[model samples]
Target: MSNPPVCRRCGEPVVASAEQYEVFERMHYVCFHYEFEHQGDPDVECPAGGCPAAGITLPSLLFRTEGLDLAQAGNTVVPAILALEKLGFAVEHHDDGFAATARGSRFVAEDPVALLGLIKLVETRRPWRATDAEIDDALGRYDL
Candidate 1:
């Protein structure tokens, strides 16, 4: 028998028909939905000219010199913590608020273009996950 397709995002076997697999880009429906369709914090829109979330970065949210408490983090920041955590960029510290991990700090310091590429991909391709080549291509296409 042929091997079942694996989801590109979560690395799980996809239980879908050939056409469904093609439609979902080999990801589970739920995984595809979350990565490509979930518009977090419906009430909050990114004020930045073209950002998907409010104009906040992992560094700005987690590595602030002054640090942040829950009230200071506010609605926009709180909603994004889980998504950033999923991306391995931040961790929540219960009532202490969120902090960036080593990997996340490196991402902020070393790869300024990564976030722009991610936003461009979500805006155009809606992939559950992107390969490096795909990110580069998206950035080029969008001139970001």
Candidate 2:
């Protein structure tokens, strides 16, 4: 008579046939696994040869500029700049060089290694696993 329960982690419906988990309450199996094993920790290393936080890391963003030498070749920077803009991250082209906006700088302040782990979680298409609130908390921890 009751509707099927929604997964607290990802806001999706929890079907009976699929695997499930309980961590204080019901959640998708994969969501629970990722949270239990990897959430809230920043010491985790990035996967080898991959970008940190889905290539959102400061160095990785900088790499885009460096790889193309955006300053010397201004037009080529458009794509990378557009990508960041689309993602809601702030970027600006200046007389001196390209730089992340304040919000962007704040994002990069988080440890790159930890971000790599978070990025890996997001790349799996499990959006609930790596939320903006969670990311802000992770980035804030560096101050302590």
Candidate 3:
């Protein structure tokens, strides 16, 4: 009818694309919007429309949840978000790291545990995840 839909992740319009999203769990086009719409994964930053990429590649999510100290979390958020973006996630670039829409957050909140969860999940895929330890430890690097 009026174009299938534009993918919010990437920055282009699309048609007939399978929108696969995984937040707390796997879901489809309709299920995703109605059910896990507002729920954002800790680190994952996938957009609502779609991954924006030709198709979804990374099929997982990893996150730390809300327990994270906002002030402390804010420090590691930027570099962490940047790392996720380099890995092909749709990051919204925030004052912290990235808020994540619905899709992107999925990958950041996958499984596994340790180091508040953020560094743990990402370490599974990207080595940069562990290196983030230095960043986290350097919280006093700047003033709140």
Candidate 4:
């Protein structure tokens, strides 16, 4: 069998249910939120027709979206961004879209029956969490 798909950013094989985000047709997730917020060109300043974003980089604007104190985090932010690209997800990060997968789409698409089953599966897994059993057990019950 072929190896599983890995995140373009993290270089790790996609874990089932770990969440994958899509961007430019690449499979990623950990940094999806931040990337989506900063999709605009970082070098372009916002037009000054009363636009509040007048001179900020797209990445900086993301910090304001959460009302977090950017000044405290600003200088240290670039390294974190690099690390997420190089190591893991950054603080305040988000994702743009779900990575494409045949089985995953089946769970997310608006099919009421499947959705309900998914909910039940998740509910069932919660109890298992307390018991130290495998979450995959719930999937086995579903014959998935």
Which has the greatest TM-score?
A: 1
TM-score winner between 1 and 2, please give it: 1
lDDT of 3 by residue, 1-144 (tens): 455444455434443343443332343444445454634542344555443221223443322232444443346645655655555556453343333334434432321111224543454556544356666767757553
Ranking by lDDT: 1, 2, 3, 4
Identify the candidate with maximal lDDT: 1
Put down candidate 4 lDDT per residue, 70-127, tens digits, no spaces. Answer: 4323455444334333322222322531111232332332322333344435534654
Q: Report the lDDT tens digits of candidate 1 across residue range 1-144.
A: 887898899988886544598787778776666567656653343333333343245443333334545432245454455555555664434353334454434222222233323433454553658789989999989977
In candidate 2, the residue pairs with backbone N, CA or C atoms under 3 Å apart (3 or more residues apart, or in different chains) clash, namely none
The 10-residue segment with the lowest total lDDT in model 4: 97-106
Error of 3 at 118 (Å): 5.9
**TM-score for predicted model 1 compared with the true structure:** 0.27
Clashing pairs in 4: 21-28, 32-94, 32-95, 33-94, 33-95, 34-94, 83-87
Task: Give the lDDT of residue 70 in candidate 4.
Answer: 40
Off by over 4 Å in 2: 1-5, 8-75, 102-144
Query: Each prediction's Cα lDDT score?
Result: 0.53, 0.49, 0.43, 0.41
Q: Per-prediction TM-score, please? A: 0.27, 0.25, 0.21, 0.21
Q: Write down the TM-score for model 4.
A: 0.21
TM-score of 2: 0.25
Q: Per-residue lDDT of 90-143 in model 2, one digit per residue for the tens?
A: 654446444444442423323222333333344445554657887799889877
